[model samples]
Target: MAFPRVSILPLLLLLLITPFSSSLSLSDTITKDSLYQLCSQPTIRKHFCIIWLTNDPTTFTLNFYGLLGLVIQKTQLYGYKNLAMMKSLVRTTTDPMLKIPYGSCVTYYESAIKSMEEAIKFAILKKYELTSEAAGKAFSSINSCEADLAGRNTVPSDVPLRNIRFKRMCNIVRVFSDVLTAKNY
Candidate 1:
């Protein structure tokens, strides 16, 4: 007895489509719940992590290392912005006192940018410990800039706010890198 032609076509189509559909679903496995779980790590700021990741449409399709790379890029951009702002201030300020802090901030931001570059390299290599360490160094650079500016009588209002946001980015990178490291071990 032979199977009908119509029945054989349906079976063949199902077999062909099943693998493609399942692979697509697997790529989309980073749901809200999973994001919540990732952000819930003790050192991570859950709200910031959730908001940042959710805002980026690409986050849903990326794995953990890819997410880390995204965060690193954002942090690097922040560092560059801060560096440029400080450089501008240093050059334009007439007051020698203001220039001192602004110059210090320029150095700090440069260091932060360097550290973030290192983080990106280590992240690409899947060296989670070095990635976390580089992020920590970047965080420390931001904190140092903040503290240096705090002591000055005159400072830009936006500097403090930028410092806060930049620190948050660094925290996310550090925590994510740490989580990845722990999972590997």
Candidate 2:
């Protein structure tokens, strides 16, 4: 005796479409992972640097304050006695290449977590103010991205991962430039 055939159309469709899923695609063209992979390829870094300098033509300006905060919080995170003793954010250049020793990664990680959380809030709010769908998606994605960044096993900024961080950095600067330049600033 043979068993009756059952309708498996839905399962077949799902399986057929699984290979073409849009789960990882970005809005326009490529995923952030693809972009980062492109960024990581040999000569792509040079191309990115060239494009960054030519297009936006600015340093990581928003992080300027955050870098200052990190410098100021050095002693708190490091248990050193002279971090806040500096004259100002700009004056703390005594050691241009001092590296934090081992055993303090977690402390710096926590400090960065707190600081980056605030920056994400600020950036998200700014994006919300733009009143555009693109901005909203970008900002929402940023919230998730930053959350992932904070959840890393190591300090996010130094983590050797491939993702949207570089692209988003360039986007922030480029978009901000577009805003300022459009407004005659």
Top candidate by TM-score: 1
**How far out, in Å, is residue 122 in model 2?**
0.7
Per-residue lDDT of candidate 1, residues 1-185 (tens digit):
99756657887687556532232222234777667777877877789889988998888878666777888998899789878888999999877888888888898999999999999999889898999999999999988888887866567778888888899899889988887776662
Q: What's the TM for model 1? A: 0.80
TM-score, every prediction: 0.80, 0.22
* Regions of model 1 farther than 4 Å from truth: 1-29
Please, what are the lDDT tens digits per residue for candidate 2 over residues 1-185?
A: 99889899987787556542222222233333433332332323445533433343232232322322222232123212111221121143333321221213323333433443444454345432231233234334434434544543443243323223333433443343233233332
Runs of candidate 2 exceeding 4 Å displacement: 1-100, 127-185
